[model samples]
Target: MSRIFKVAVIGGGIGRAHIAEGYSARPDLFEVVVLCDIDPVRLGNVGKQFGIARQVASFDEVLAMPDIDIIDICTPPSLHLEQCLAALAAGKHVVCEKPLVGSLAEVDRLIAAAHGAKGRLMPIFQYRFGNGLQKARHIIQQGLAGKPYLATIETAWNRDAAYYSVPWRGRFATELGGALLGHAIHAHDLLSYLMGPVASVFARTATLVNPIEVEDTATASLEMANGALASLSVTLGSARELSRLRLCFEHVTFQSALEPYAPANDPWHIIPNSKAAATAIDAALADWRFVPSRFAGLFAAMHTALVDGSELPVTLQDARNSLELVTALYHSAEQRLPVDLPLRPDHPAYGSWLPEPFRG
Candidate 1:
């Protein structure tokens, strides 16, 4: 029998979205028993809205709750590592937001911490749990897509002065990164989610789109582990926001819909190299099942994993890989050279990917 996991959600900002779109979407699997926030106004507002009876402004208080089965850390990027460590130490399952930690060193430490803890950890990359991307993943996994050739992914969205009005939005100390970490992270993660591991990367980034410490405009060229090549483009200056992925393989060419927020929804231009490939593709998806998009889909999968004691929907290593890619990109952009993946501890950006001036 599957049990409803009791949750204590920390942080009121994106925390509300997690409760609304994620936990609320799966009532049978989760129950958000507590809402914790440092801000009393936000805590009261979100708690009243969600009808969560138990509200506290203490992270340690929630960590002490023996009834809480999960600690969903929706706090800012900076607070993630500390909260995650504490939550895991408390023997509660954890769900953390993206760009898991500031640096590869911190990620390694968090990974190590999770290993010794009783509770499991799942990173948020909810974008993967969608129809279009899943179908593409299914086709490729079924060996119908053949060898990967090339891919072009673009994450172009707008973030103006008003958006950066929040004290934490543009600063390196709190937000970690600008568009690359905060905005285009999901799209970039989707790149590895579909295309696989990266071998090396050459990147260039600029802050032209906004007056921010981190880069708002960036481009990267990558060589995949599978011997395929890829190009990644990200910006916060696009007039018409769009996120698109075009992947070419020996047998199939897939192009995702140009929806900035929900590119993986449906209606990908799936082209087969030959009629044989077409028939196989059709046969593969003959009994297609509906997949709930975004957080809804992600939370459902997490339930199954926790209940069945199986692998998580999004693993620690998956988060590590995403961060590693980002680290490499930042290093490449700084050095003006191609940087290889599986970065060693000695890498300059391993400790902190922030620029020298911004490094704390």
Candidate 2:
């Protein structure tokens, strides 16, 4: 097994967070070989701070480097598809941040690139590594949840005008969508991960609290393939930022923390509703093993999948499922009707959703 793989990071802000995690959690596994950003100041600052000798002004430079193994994309959502396609075409694996692209068609193109290049592509849904979320996933897969009945996902984060003042923060073209796309994506991914793929969505959105061109608040009702009903609320005008998920089943109940960004690491309360469920859960936990909270756990898993020929936790199909939900949610909001799952290619809102005129 290789001791360290060369990594190049594009973009500075959130890319720095991923770099910090990579350096802190498993320094022996990854090396920060290159840093790329359009802003030379930010690029030089990060390269010097991390002692990474190679500082490039554009992603193309990083892609040209023969030694680079992975490209960690930290740019805005709008840039993901192009960067990912370039990296994969250059024979480097990709680790792009969530909300991969503004449209499902772009996602399909990236997926095709990965297929042709035979390079790995991982969408950063880092919240999956949290201990709490892992625990809930275990219970559900173990049948302790006994066919989920209902679930609720709530993401209320306060992002005032000052928050959107950042140059690329609040525009339809750059930020992609709005509260649902930017803020609540993680929570929504969590919901889809726990429950199954959604079959339909009915949604309404508003730009009430923020001065951005996008919606700051959205409410959506979901119907899952397994006959489970779910509700989702995403907002950026709350008093504080928090996220929580509640799942009710025939035999047990699972509840996760409301922490922003790290909800997966918190403790989850699993209450068995009956003696049979209690015994089943207890037996499962007796054989359970604990995995440490490493930010590069996803990378590690992907590495293992690459070397050992195992299944990747987040696959292209998984990304498609997440993107499908994003597309469906936006379509529902635009048409003001329940948009069904597996949207066709000709759907008017297939690639984007424009906000309606505010009646208020």
Clashes of each: 0, 2
Per-model CA lDDT versus the true structure: 0.91, 0.81
Cα error, candidate 2, residue 97 (Å): 1.0
TM-score against native, each model: 0.98, 0.94
The residue-by-residue lDDT of candidate 2 on 1-360, one tens digit each, is: 566778889988888878887543667678888889889899889888888888888777788899988898999887888888888889888888878877777777877788888578878777777776787888888777887899999998888767888888888778878888888888888888898888889998889997778888999999998999999998888888888889998888888877876777768888899988898888888876665443666676666776666777678777777878877887788878898998767876555554434211
Q: Give the CA lDDT, 0 to 100, for residue 330 in model 2.
A: 79
TM-score for model 2?
0.94
- Candidate 1 — what's its lDDT? 0.91
For model 2 the local lDDT of residue 264 reads: 77
lDDT of 2: 0.81
Model 1 ranges off by over 4 Å: none
Candidate 1 local Cα displacement, residue 294, angstroms: 0.4
